[model samples]
Target: MQRTFLQPDDVRDLVTDQFGGGRRPIALDRLTGGSKKGVYRLRLDDHSTAILYVWSAGENYWPPSLTVPDDPFTDASGAELFAVSHAALVAAGVGTPQVLALVRGSRYFDADVALVEDAGVDTLEAVMERDPGAAVGPLSALGDGLRRLHTTVGAEYGKLAAVARGEASQRRRVEDVIVDRALGQLRGAAAHDGRIAEAHDRIAGHVRHLRGAVAERRAYGLIHGELGPDHVLVSPAGEPLIIDIEGLAYFDVEWEHAWLQLRFGDAYPMLRPVDLDPHRLRLYRYAQVLSLIEGPLRIADTDFPERQWMLDLAERNIAKALAAV
Candidate 1:
């Protein structure tokens, strides 16, 4: 069944309250690709625009049973998570949409709503495809921003929100947590795809081998758990502004480079990523591939517009993961 999304009328009062009656909402259209929250482009009568992020039970696709709210690697959604991640990114000098107004327990809807500046509609992926050199400046800026983000670490490794609240972490080492996530993702992928199921044992064995090869580390870097090119917006001024930042965590930077390698592909070199441990990168590559395979397959079950793309991504990563083993 299709659900009704918020319209201009639904948030007309909100726009009036925030931007005043002179800037009432003229149009409200939902943007594609945000599975955890409702991303809508709100246009005002004067033609100015803002992005609305709504966190409600109706918007989120993940079930409550599957979420580990405090875990660094679990379903990291909700208004609190977004606020915390946004604060962390802002403090680290990362580019993001400026927060306009934060409405909690809104009268329009029983949810949290955030009004933010519009960072343009074109993502880094589209900009990169428009021309080979289109993404170079943005990617270089992203490299500099990521350096500041990664170097901004904490005493305990976990979601930035938990760390902010002085929560104690159960995992002793980042490597151990990564290996556990890999094993979990391996099982999830095997259950979803027959080809992955066939080589499950072999892949599991290789994961165990890689686990042992990783050395102990005392520190980890902050990371945007999912940094796909699509998640990055290329502003008109040729800047890379990060979106969907609810997954900021203090973890191994190699986990980040592994994602950059997978998502950025041929364009990875433009970012000029630095100081990644080869051993962590190797293990993280397998873990990242398994995660990529499992994630797309899982999200494909939702009412996402790019359903076929998700399945294709899963298939490609499955091939990559199987070959690596």
Candidate 2:
């Protein structure tokens, strides 16, 4: 197992500092499913539990093709951006863990840590997998939750850091970001295979045309860039709470809807409403697939299991995108 950044002693001390002395954490159970952060369930001396999220230092969670800055602690001073985003979601009446404390670059952990209330809810993915038939309620609740989330908007369409710092002028358009990234990935993949290179040339014009079409009709809102079944937790009573607000951004709502549809369209058809433009959604879907394959394609070899799967997926998505065009 990879060594976790947050230790038990560190959790105990953090809890004690937030709640005062003598309230030490009795247990620290590392939770799974985070890609770039360590999540732990910390049990306090009083038996209450909290969620500790330790941010990884300088890890790029997104594909290398994307232009997101490499800075790990993009959150403002004392993790102000992180705290503000969570607070905004809570204020919007969305179900989220109450942020108890935001530890910015602690010496002990050497990373930013957030202590939040543990909701002790099962993830929507878990519920869906365990009982597919009973997943309708939670899926519907998730749709409604997304509707509420989209209502929270930002001043510009980019990283929260740039927007919060009055640097929105430097922000790029969502359409441009997607198309540029897809082009870069497709070009790189093309270099490895003649078929991929041919497909890249064919898709290049289609991507640009689709980008223009979508840009003319895009609506901006707060989108959970990485929202999926796993990010949604459901209470015993069936209410859904969204976690992993790190990817939150103001962008085309179609991007979020497209991603949700790509992941859960068949399992939960109602997850995607019927009104979204099919062409734009397909464009985003193509962009998403390109993004997924970039990391694995960047590798020099295809012997790894993940690399082979990503290559196969890339082919399928390329065909799908071409057929749509």
Candidate 3:
């Protein structure tokens, strides 16, 4: 995969082509913090600002070589889905960035880009990191926003594309989908370190036991998939606008709640009363750990700084899951 960077002028031209002429960009600042995409804050001549999101061809996953045969969406399709999901969330009264235009399969650059209304400077992660005490308001707002998001339900549970095409009925149950993917990831990891095979089988048995429970209690809805503090931007007035809608999918609302608990349970205890299923939450936690394990293990030879940390997290979470059993 070839790397590509869009200059300020190129972005200005793209925006002008979409929104019309006479809009001049005063400053283009590359923003850091996202793992999957490059973001830039473009300050316009009218004192307004917009966000430019760019995603390279094969950089969606770590190691840049891992591929899933069952996954139907490409980078271009993902950008389009992001726009559609953002629109749906906004229409549902959820705080989200307003997408202006999406440039897919552009010849000028080897990446897909989306121009959107600037959400804010402070992500919920930054707010919580800077002041955990004051984070209650934003976190509560985030919880409320997620509740609103879950109200948008789908006919079936699976990928967004499959749902859109009315093919979600043919897809496997969300629990089985996750379990199969986790097992595949574990098998891939075991190719490098055979020690993971036993743990994989053990976790598989635990996951299988929870499948019946998941089948009985799951609700299909629009899930943010990864709603950690990082994807939420808190406006100055304390409104929480969700960004990075790429992971939007038709899945169990409990999955979203579970991820929230797994990521921020200790820092914020207010979510304990949100009525999440304990068994499903545990299953999702195991799935999250397996996901964390797969990426780093696939690229262990690289200079990726987080490789060891991810492996350690997976190991620790594996131990915790085992002890809970």
TM-score of each: 0.94, 0.80, 0.83
Task: State the displacement of the C-alpha of residue 321, model 1, in Å, after optimal TM-score superposition.
Answer: 1.5
- Comparing 1 with 3 on lDDT, the higher-scoring candidate is 1
Q: lDDT tens string, model 2, 225-250?
A: 76788888887777778888876666
Model 3, span 50-162: residue lDDT tens: 89887764434345544444432223235767776776787777888778878887654667788888877898888888998778887777767677778777767656756
Residue-wise C-alpha lDDT for candidate 1, range 228-275, written one tens digit per residue: 899999888988889999888888888888888888999898777878
lDDT of 2 at 3: 44
- Per-residue lDDT value at 311 in model 1: 96
Model 3 gets an lDDT of 0.68
In candidate 3, which residue ranges exceed 4 Å CA deviation?
1-4, 18-23, 45-47, 58-77, 107-111, 212-218, 271-274, 299-325
Supply the global lDDT for candidate 1.
0.84
Give, for candidate 2, the lowest lDDT window spanning 10 residues. 69-78
**Ranking of models by lDDT:** 1, 3, 2
Taking all chains together, the TM-score of candidate 3 against the true structure is 0.83
Give one clash count per candidate, in the order shown.
0, 0, 0
**Clash pairs of candidate 2?**
none
**Residue 189 alpha-carbon offset, candidate 2, angstroms:** 4.2
lDDT for model 2, please.
0.67
lDDT of each: 0.84, 0.67, 0.68
